[model samples]
Target: MGRNTRKRRMPLATKIVAGAAALTVGGGGLVWANFYASAHEDHSGHNRTRSAAAQVATIDCPDVGQKIRDVPDRARGEVDGELATMDSQITNAYQRLATTRRAQAGDAQFVQNSILGPLKDRRKAIIDRIQLEINRAGGKADDNLDELAACQGRPADQMQNGDGQNGDGQMDDGQNQGGDGGDGNGVAGPVADDFVDINDVQPNTRDSRNGLAADGDGGSTGTFTTDCGVNENNLFNSDNLIAAPGVDNGAHHTHDYVGNQDNDAFSSDEDLANADTSCQNQGDKSTYYWPVLRLQDGTQEFDANDQGGGAEGNIGKILKPAEAQIRFVGSRQGDVVAMPKFLRIITGDAKSFTNGDANANTSWSCSGFEDRQVTDKYPLCPDGSQVLRTVNFQSCWDGQNIDSANHRDHMAFVQEDGSCANGFQAVPQLQIRLAYDIPTPTVENGQVQNPYAVDSFPEQLHKPITDHNDFINVMDEDLMNEVVDCINRGEDCQ
Candidate 1:
């Protein structure tokens, strides 16, 4: 496929709230709504006779990893293991909560006592161990880490539910009144309100202040493209070597990988360096992977019964991308430098649903309507326009480390002026554009038909805000220098 070298930056919005309804009829045919109400909303003098008590839509836990900024290299292995344990704990808790709805209806405190309370204890111990590891390695652990152990049940009203027709033709009251066919794991999210017609979105201007700056007159405006074929090899896995190394099912969601062939929970830097490449240019052996998009048409995929697949609330037939365009572009401030070997960069957050949009760097839009992008809602593209997922990796390196305790401090995005911050170096920014030809999903009667969603943690409920991408620089030193030189000289090369 031909490549588009034009600069198409993916702008992460401050916050995008897609409207969705979470209505369920529990045992005894009692109608309940998953109303995620505002924190300060008053329920005084309100009539509650007709409605069953509001139910907890999902679990909300503090992202402990995002909070931990410093950990001794010696203790990183222990810390990462503990973090992965926390994730599994959440998953198990969510699974229990999802499967025990009938018992929950009988006892109001079932969720709090049996689920949240026990989960808190488990997480607290995990946090304590994480602290001990840091302290043992001569690094001070954050005292507030223990405070993040408590998790709360998110009320359904907090989720943005649009006023639309319910299954019975009743207008949605922003509360739970309609039924949605969730991924069949009690995590019914990305409902009708989660998808908006692309034509309905207004054309938006690129917010240069929040995105990669456009090429300027004196800057290195050249580009280098690498033809990494779409992952036709079916190289799928649920492991995230960068985030949760040495742990199986670290991601807890399936990912489609291209470029590097040997990527999993156990791959070391040397393993990746020696792996074969899918890129046309054999010199580019870097790994690029992201959560696979699935059409919720009820087709049983290979992982339908597996840990990170249907069993964990990630369902539907996986769709392979038609185009995987990996390109390296010059910085707008000055000449770019070579990215260090084995440098890891993760753009966007996979837990932005409960964690908030502070780290969310998603750009979901239609192929033809790339300018009208969204960070939360999935775009319902027209027949010919394909769904597009584009991300721009951090273009500034801290100059000292290729990896960090949180995997983020080592890399940084360029400032609004297109210059690296003090003590950071400018490097060729990696922009990955993924395109998929998915059938447009239909939303009617507040029910989505053939809904498509990206794989996410069960607690995330398949939110688009949870979309993210990962990359690891494994390019040989010679090729890396050539990439930098090509960009600095303002010449487009392949």
Candidate 2:
């Protein structure tokens, strides 16, 4: 009976169809809701992801930019620091060299006093060593800086290449490729080369004749002679010889006159005794000698007696001869003689003479004489007394020709009568000449060749001993400026 009620029911097929339709509607609704929900949620998550990625990219960009910007500054700082260090090292080397030079100068003084022999070789060695050290320091600094620069990004050709297909093609892996080049780890090159060689230096010496004078007593007359060759003998010999009692005899014997009666009256027995004693001691040796003459009333006269022999015993011998004669003699031993106060004179070779040339043969007219006289050619001495005596032609010309020439080259002396004594205090002067080989590019056999050639004197410097103290000040300023520059540039000074 229930069945009959559902029955008014349509056909079984219709009921089934209605159920199916309802189920289809329900499933479609569920699918639509789920899709809508999912779409909204997906949008939020995507937005967050995009924002995070953007933030990361922005952060990375600034870091990279800052690093790039800092590279140069850091490099500059390092360069400056290296430069400062190099400067200090160079300055120290210079100081050491200067100190050594000063010490050598002191040694020279000792040698002058006969306390030591010449230290020419030692001084030269010291100077050479200092030069070597300076060179080494400069070279090392250059090499180190060169290597640093190469590491920093020099030689652009050495950079690596990434594939074009990749998005990261332009990116660098931050690896250095270049090796040490010329510039130090971004540091500047070494300081300039400035030094003087010792071989070019010159020293001063003197000769005198006043030391050979005889004792001022009528009892005996001492005499000695030098054979400085015919030219020198004629230049210094006297025309008239004087003799007095015992003094005249001694004077005659000293003058090397075997026979002459005019001046023998003034000869003295003491002079003859002294002369004989000198001859006996020398085993009766006889030699030719040149007499030193004095000018009185425009007449040449011999005062001290000198023998014609080059015997060493003749140097301080007293003679009392009863005769006087004028004779010319030639003896090589007389070329160089030394007495208590006098020294023999000889003509030096024109080419060999470091002091004078052949143009002025009268350079030795005065013995042991020092005077300063002003001439149109040479300047007056510093004391304005007489013309300064210069050995070299250039020295004689001095300010007139070479205004830059050293004043010390022309010596100042005190003139007592015709004798010279007491030399003026001299100031130390140094001249430095620098020469080196320069490489040049040339084409040989159709090929480019770099070859070195000796360059002309490239530089010259003059320094006074007093300037040594200023080096410290110069070095300090240099160091401070370098450090300040590095700091301001934001360079890596280390």
- In candidate 2, stretches whose alpha carbon ends up further than 4 angstroms from where it belongs are 1-416, 423-494
TM-score: model 2 vs. ground truth = 0.13
List residue ranges in candidate 1 displaced over 4 A.
1-53, 158-187, 206-210
Model 2 steric clash total: 58
> lDDT per residue, candidate 2, 18-88, as tens digits?
23322312111100001011111233324322211111000000011011111232232232222222222
TM-score, predicted candidate 1 vs. hidden true structure? 0.85
Consecutive 10-residue window with the lowest summed lDDT within model 2: 463-472
RMSD of 2: 46.3
- Evaluate all candidate structures by whole-model CA lDDT and list the values in order: 0.74, 0.18
